[model samples]
Target: MTHRRKTLLRAIAPVAALTLALTACGSDDGDDSGDKKNDKSSSESSDTSGSDDGDDATDEPTEEAPANTGDLPLGQAASEEKEIKRGDGTLKAKITADKVDTGENADLTAAGFSADKVKGKYPVYAYFTYEITEQTGEISPGTDLNSTTAVLDAEGKPGSRFIAIGGQPLKGGCPEKDRELEWKKGTKATLCTTFLMDEGKEPTKLAYGMVNPLLWAVK
Candidate 1:
């Protein structure tokens, strides 16, 4: 009976040792799987943070007003010819600001402008030559070639007119024709427009069109 019991104890001991080894291996595998899941979660969190930073860079505003990038481009030089569709897109006019005259206070006073009106103002005379290159409708004399033309002051603002009344030729050759004549295609003419600049300031640019004006350097 003692020999039989000793053999049985040895067998049971080996079986218990095998069971303990298998449990230890299972615990190691569980630890490895948990570490892999933690690593994957950390990598996903880092990727999300990087993506949020890129979205902030593109939402900033600009410091200055954007330039005109429209149907008509800006900054054409004086004496360069440009064909623009005017008169409600009924006529295509070929136009150029041929000459610019400045420092005309005395001339303004002589040209029927009151002394009080001419005082404290620098005057400008801009002569433009234009022709109706093409027209789909009738053009009136009231639609003068100098319409939509302006002189920009040093501050990029349009200069005010010394005299607002139209239709009369001023004494110093700044003529305004107030006729009711009709114009046809291929008709050409020259006209003068005037502006009253601020005292002690010179005209910086001749501008065509009130909004996003096509600028010509006053040379």
Candidate 2:
């Protein structure tokens, strides 16, 4: 070989080796970049799966507790003052059933009621006290005791009610009079109600109010 050609071959050989080394480094960098991209995709997939699991856990239904709606005694009803609303006025009041009487046929006869009026029936008289503790917005304390009160038989139904007019006094000593005077704070009233049930059917309960009534067991 010529001396000039030998020097040129040596220089070209080093240049080719440097070029090969640079190409190998570039290929390695590309591989590392692809691996990093695959890792990121896998991490994103795992995060999405975790988020879906969290949503599923949150979507599960939960149970709620039941409310109490049991019947309460007369004394308990008296102890609990209820807010009564009428005609844009509000009144806080309580009722106490003090006495109950099951009348006889002789007693009915003495009260000027015919035997046919109460024949094959049980007469019931319930005495109660109505009290007003707080009043607001011009509310009246007067309540229709004969209409509001009921004597329930064994079938959980109201019996025939006897409403006396003109403030007549019953033989059982329950007056038919209901007072409607000045209703102020700390005012109270004694009221009575009467009911008649068929013979062999006894009164089991006494209830007051038309809705969400207060209950009392017959003694």
Give the least accurate 10-residue stretch of model 2, judged by summed lDDT.
21-30
TM-score of each: 0.53, 0.55
Q: Show model 2 residue runs off by greater than 4 Å.
A: 1-69, 78-80, 85-90, 137-146, 165-168, 176-181
Best by TM-score: 2
lDDT of 1: 0.39
| Each model's total of backbone clashes | 0, 0
Candidate 1: pairs in clash: none
**Alpha-carbon local distance difference test for all models:** 0.39, 0.42
**Candidate 1, superposed: residue stretches over 4 Å from native:** 1-89, 164-171, 176-182
